[model samples]
Target: MSFDPAQALRLAHDTLDIEAAAVLGLKRRLGDDFARAVALVLGITGRVVVMGMGKSGHVGRKIAATLASTGTPAFFVHPAEASHGDLGMIQPRDAVLAVSNSGEVDELTVLLPLVKRLGVPLLAMTGHPQSTLARHADVVLDSGVEKEACPLNLAPTASTTAQLALGDALAVALLDARGFRAEDFARSHPGGALGRRLLTRVSDIMRSGDAVPRVLPGADFSHLMREMTRKGLGASAIADADGRVLGIFTDGDLRRLVETGRDLRALTAREVMHAAPRTIAADALAAEAAEVMEKHRITVLLATGADGRLTGALNSNDLMRAKVI
Candidate 1:
């Protein structure tokens, strides 16, 4: 038989449509139990334990990660492992979130007695409220979907999506309740690019001290160019005789002066320097410095201390190296 590409495409589209509808239906399913679950998690001083089996386990692991990154401290434990010896990971102060479509996963049922004995609060997400797992839980989040996207009705597709969405709902609710901030998220994800962008400070990545390029305002153009070359920052700060900043001169100025046929050797720094160039405070965040650079469409900016003395210089490349961009 010839393969029907058009029919396969139609089937794929149908599956996506059904799954999207299933997820949308869960919005109305949210109720007081969801609020209670959020309260239970927020009130705890310890971590949250998420447990599930098979497809549910995959969803559980992601939920645990999202919760931990947002504000709530949590992790996932395999249900079968809990039956063996992993139940020790669940502390009395912690709460347990269990995911099971039929609420009859053998491993979960075996671990139910241990969950109850430990006095840990249990939150259940299942299709059946009358199921044993639901009856055992302190709060039941009904993730019931009318049908699976799988045409054969055997594969766990839409049901798993519903469970994942419900878990996110729980995480977002807890995040708002805890007043979670971007810095808090960055702390949990320090190795990621976003973490570097948010957590890194200007002081952490800026070049200072001898690395800074600076020249007195009255210094000749030749001396300023020498400082810029020696420092390798493409620019040098024009400072007052007392070492307070005046402005900056860069390669762009050099190009303009060349076009005007001004002899660099004969010209003074004051003749070619930009007056009152935009500067950032040394204490300002590196991310903020990046924003300023982008807004001005300039590649180089001078950093100054509170006294308006040249502190350091930042180039666009520094931000890229720090992953602030």
Candidate 2:
């Protein structure tokens, strides 16, 4: 059969509207039960063991991940697998979040008795409060949807969306209650770009010791250029004998000097240097270094210690190589 583009677009719009309405419907129903669910999970001493079957199981897995990543300890378990032995993973200190739109999946209902016997707090996320899962649950979260986004009104589209939204709400509520910060999130995601931005310090990627371009304030232009070339940082710190930074000179300054047709041989580091150059603490995050560089329109930053002594130096290239920019 030939397809009509207008009909297809209308169908897509209808589906989105239905799903969006279903999620919006959840807002009115959220009240004491949602708060109780959050309290139960927060009060638990162990992880949140989430279980479901079929599409609900997929949503359960995502909910578990969101919870774990956002500071709450949680993991997903298959209802069938739980009966086989995975049930051992659920301890009395843990809370069980069971998802079922019907609240009557035989695979899940069958485990309800055992979950209760284990003395674990059971939280049910279901559409049917009268169903077996909700009846046995210690706290019931109404994940009911007015309808599904499917054309046949049978698939788990709107309901799943509601479930996912509810899950996100729970995770964020727990995150706020626990005072979870970005640094804590970064620690859990160290291998990702966000983690590097938050956890990587200037000291971790800065060129230190001999690699840091440095010259005495009285050093000649040739000496400063040599130091910049040797360090390959495009900039050099002009410091005193005690290693305190006096100023900074960059390749940009060199270009300006050349453009003016100045006598380069007679110029000293102190004669043409940016006094009180942009500096960052060695312990500052690389993300902050990137910010300082962008804000000042400078390519290099001198890292200093608490004692106001030059500790290291980093350029835009270093930030890029470290994946902090």
Candidate 3:
């Protein structure tokens, strides 16, 4: 009974094997009922109100979030809370997804009649399809497992894994059926990495007005140097009188100019600028600018508006600060 490393490794492997089998079992049992559940959720005019208790409740909450974020409106409502005044959150248009391994948890079973009375569809995800919760449901999704990963076979291990897999399956199926796009998912997950890449526009992150380093084409070398130094963007855009970007001069250009042994003070902004510099539209997605920078192996990008005039300036640093890269 003393600690044994080999035995512990075997137990861990056994646990993973059991859980994997439990999830695979769901695939074999998946059929018409799963499709019906998806259809019911699609048909609903309101959010999917997921209800559960204990470990199953935790899985239910994740399912609700996955559904809600993937274009199916959904939210978790604990069964214990539903028995209380929280039941009011379930409207007539909402669909209920009730989760319980046994399908007969007292708190959950007690509320079935009331949920049915609301005239909303009830989808039961349970191991015991014959239990009261499934009997009362409009559709039954079997989340059964042959055994638990726990040594005592009492803890909700494999069963919960199966439930989670089934929930992800449901979310994926619903996402495809609804034709949900990445942009749609990004809208719901604005704080996540994908959201920043998809939802952040160039205008949102670019430096505008006085923040952008720019000088009139007629400006002297000292004036251009001051603009580039004051802005600290490592580059200065040479623009025409009407605000149209004519060219760009960067630190690289300055280094090469210094190497030529020419007097830097006598030059005008237009005299040494690189004309037809790369520019991105102000309304373009920030992700596009990242791609352009990486492809050209450059850092800075000038942003222009509809009239083809420089509107703002952006660089790899801007994209990094916005977490869009």
- Stretches off by above 4 angstroms in model 1 are none
Give TM-scores for every candidate, taking all chains together and pairing residue i with residue i: 0.96, 0.98, 0.97
Candidate no. 1 TM-score: 0.96
Q: For residues 1-325, could you state the per-residue lDDT of candidate 1 as single tens digits? A: 9999999999899889988988888887777888898888887888999999999999999999999899899999999888778899989999999999999989898888889999999999998888999999999999988889888988999999999889999999999898998888888889888788788877777889889898877788778888999999988888887667788898888888799876678877777889999998888888989999999999888888888877888999999998898
What is candidate 3's local distance difference test score? 0.94
What RMSD does each model have against the real structure? 1.4, 1.1, 1.2
For candidate 3, the TM-score is: 0.97
Which runs of model 2 end up more than 4 angstroms from their true locations? none
Local distance difference test, each candidate: 0.88, 0.94, 0.94
- Given candidate 1, what's the lDDT at residue 273? 88
lDDT: worst 10-residue window of model 1? 262-271
Candidate 3 per-residue C-alpha lDDT over 1-325 given as tens digits, one digit per residue, 9 for 90 to 100 = 6999999999999999999999989999999999998888999899999989999999999999999899998999988888779999989999999999999899999999998889989999999999999899999999999999999999999999999999999999999999999999999999999999899999999999999999999899999999999999999999988999999999899999999999989999999899999999999999999999999988999999999999999888889999997
Report the number of the highest-TM-score candidate. 2
